[model samples]
Target chain A: MEKADHLSMKDEPEVQGEPTKTAVHLSTKDRPKVPGEPTKTGTSMVDTAAAAVQSFAPLNQIHQHLCAFHFYAYDMTRQVEAHHFCSHINEDMRQCLIYDGPDPNARLIGLEYMVTEKLFMTLPDDEKKLWHTHEWEVKGGFLFMPGVPEVMQRQDLEKVAKTYGKVFHFWQVELGHELPIGLPNLMMAVTRDGQLYPEMIKETEKQFGISIEKERESRAYMKGPEHGIHPLANGGGKGLKLELREVDIKPVESVPRVFV
Target chain B: MASSGDEDQVPPGDPVTVSTLVIDAGTKIMQRRLPVKQMNTHVSTFAIYGGDMSRQIETHHYIHRVNDEFLQCAVFASDHSDAPLIGIEYVISDRLYENLPQDEQKLWHSHAYEVKSGSWAYPRLPEVVASPELKNIAKTYGKFWCTWQIDRGDKLPMGAPELMMSPQGVGQGVLRPELVKRRDEKYNISTDELKQRRAEIAEPEWINPMADYWKQHGKCFVLDIVTVEMNRNEKFP
Candidate 1:
């Protein structure tokens, strides 16, 4: 909520010129570049920056934070690797991180939580099949179901860790521990349209015992993985100047309770 | 005011001899007499081109004929665009000038004809040929080709004849007496009907059928070169 407030303040006067917008672009591009860069013309510079940063890290990293903090998507591992890997590296970063096929387990993990019938139907076949099976009869016919328990399933956690990395990353300045101004609300607001409004964020936070905040007293520069938010330092590459502060927002708030 | 040693100084005749006269396409323009002063703003100037004398006379007479029929008809207003006048220049010997009709010859010196406005519309030439209106104009004037102005903001009517006419900036003209007479004789329509028909016929989609027909045959319709040259001279299509 505080983050959204700060962002509105920041964005209000930002429309005066292209400098702040350009800042976002340059910030995202603070990475090594790769060969055969796609041309950027007429496209908003912000998209280019986000794309550049996505290339620096694995899609699993982005996916992990996104799922942990917001809605869950099944079969995200293959999709992330296939569609997102090594796509946004600046030319210099391309020299450093070649798009070689490396073991993804070292950097990521996948989660396999129980989903509702509605949620199961919402997912594709490959994703829905990742759970257990059950059978029951409804009005017109007998229904065969992939039975997933209501509680935070063990296999789901394992899957999450396997696909997205074990340590999810968020950003903090060199020694500071608080979540930066807009990032936390930004994380809460990431599902689709814009940021979640203040009321929704509060309601969701109260319903889920999880805390996305980092402890002020902690001396560690990186937020510990147990905190469910990883902190990583970004920036410092050619053609990029400002350092980026990022946090991985994961999807842990909506696990169903298993009665068994 | 001749100097003391200027006994042999003779007045220079027309700069170029009529027999050897040569004027490139950009030098002359034809303007229909209208209250054009209303259109010019501080930045906007009517484009004027050097045109042949007789064509200029016809254009001017055409304006007078229209004004006499439809007193106070607002036709070519300059207020819509910022482009300056642009067209060609021609040097006609007195012999050619005398051959023109008495009424047209009288129009040569009246407000019915406006001299070149010294305005340049664009840096490059127009690529499209003479306008359909001009082709029809040529038909009325008994000539194969002549210049005409498309009213400001109005495009040329499609299916215009192949006549040597340069596309000028947007221009509109009141209905001339001959045109009104012809309309009454041919279709029994009024000036209002003509205006409505003109608007309906100038849609951009009107050219699609021609384009599609050409595409079906795996061939393309190319504009005439003379029209292209006229556009090049007028800096308009």
Candidate 2:
């Protein structure tokens, strides 16, 4: 079988003799004046300068990319594809910055923090409801991390299966907002069949050249959360509703030790 | 997939005889780029919690300039390769910031002090190449959040996220001498010297009073998360 063209892009990072560089001239007068040109150029030039001296220690750790879908807590009917660029802080937790697509032009939509079940239980009841479980996304093969082998995936998926994530999205792409204008919205993951758009699943499968059915079969034996998901999680099946209210920032005790 | 059985198929006398390498060589690699790959710029600075100015953390920002209107960064605890990602910051031009409602404006802070005090650093860039751009960033506003307080030595990012403020005026903005001295030693650049170089860039007179609320109004904003009925006869807060 001929592999999917886009899937080949992930499987093979660089193609030999394919002349990847392309340069084109632009007629600036033909279009409306674009904004922020100076900053963009400044970034490129400064990044070039910084690249010679400073090391990007933390960013270099983001090697894993997971493809999944998310729903707005206020309205589960609105869902979107979420691509996660993640790194492990430790076995107990992982943090990820999410974007709309995997390509260079993708929009950065939000971020997420995933914690172990042990840690999840430590949270206050109110805080726990803000998070969603990942058992279905993993065991049902709704979530996939590309480029790694099945062996490596199974190893990580085992841990991911038991984790819970709290996500916030700044961009309302589903609402057709041109810019990220409003307050960030809380995002949740669909827990069962028919919740996620099936078309997205089919599209993800086509683009990655993988089988969700096969993945589900292999992950069937993995354990779910030991005590089952807390009732408070996923809005307690009450349809999570999010709101922003003003709260006072409390003061922390001053550090007694002075910086000498 | 690279096969263990293909170990013998590697070209004879090859210095690195790996089964995976042989398979990779046969299939070749493709050039595929990602959005995060364009995140080449790095800025190092410090931020204080909005609710309390005493709680501060050193921030390393790897920026991806989306356009003229916004520059978002993935923040880390340290400059080390394995440093934890402590939070995220969304920066915007003064024009875009001015358009935001008064309440939304409170969530952001100004960068004039960070710039004027010479506290922000461009790490590898020479002062000459960076100063011009730093001048532009000096007038901008930033909304930063620290998911986990690395300074407090938390093992995990627990509790709700904290909204961070940039040190502003003299009484409200003085950073600990130790933090300054340590940052200078790591980058080997004197804040005093950078301060002098940046003095010519006058502060923006139009800084919104709504911004840097902790500094201006003596209070800070906190995240309020709650679950209510979605279809209730009500409007969003």
Q: Interface RMSD of the predictions, in order shown? A: 39.6, 10.0
C-alpha lDDT of residue B33 in model 2: 27
The CAPRI quality class of candidate 1 comes to incorrect
What lDDT tens digits, residue by residue, belong to model 1 across residues A1-260? 44332222223332211112111111111211211213223222322332333221111111111112211111010011100111111111100011111222111111112222322233333222222211100100111011222122222222122111111111111111111111100000021222122333332334333222321112122221232221110000001111212122112233222222
Give me the runs in candidate 2 sitting further than 4 Å from their true place: A1-43, A121-126, A147-152, A207-214, A238-243, A247-260, B1-33, B230-237
The B-chain TM-score of model 2 reads 0.81
Model 1 C-alpha lDDT per residue in residues B19-44, reported as the tens digit of each score: 21111111111111112111111111
Model 1 chain A: lowest-lDDT 10 consecutive positions = A180-189
TM-score of each: 0.15, 0.78
Return the top candidate by TM-score. 2
Off by over 4 Å in 1: A1-11, A14-154, A162-260, B1-237
Q: Which candidate has the highest lDDT of all? A: 2
List model 2 lDDT by residue over A1-260, tens digit each.
22221222112232221222211111111111213445466656766776667677667656567878887676665567788887655556667888777766566778888887888887777778778899988999888776655665776688788888988877655444444545566778868776654555666788778888898999998876888888887756554543444545443334332556
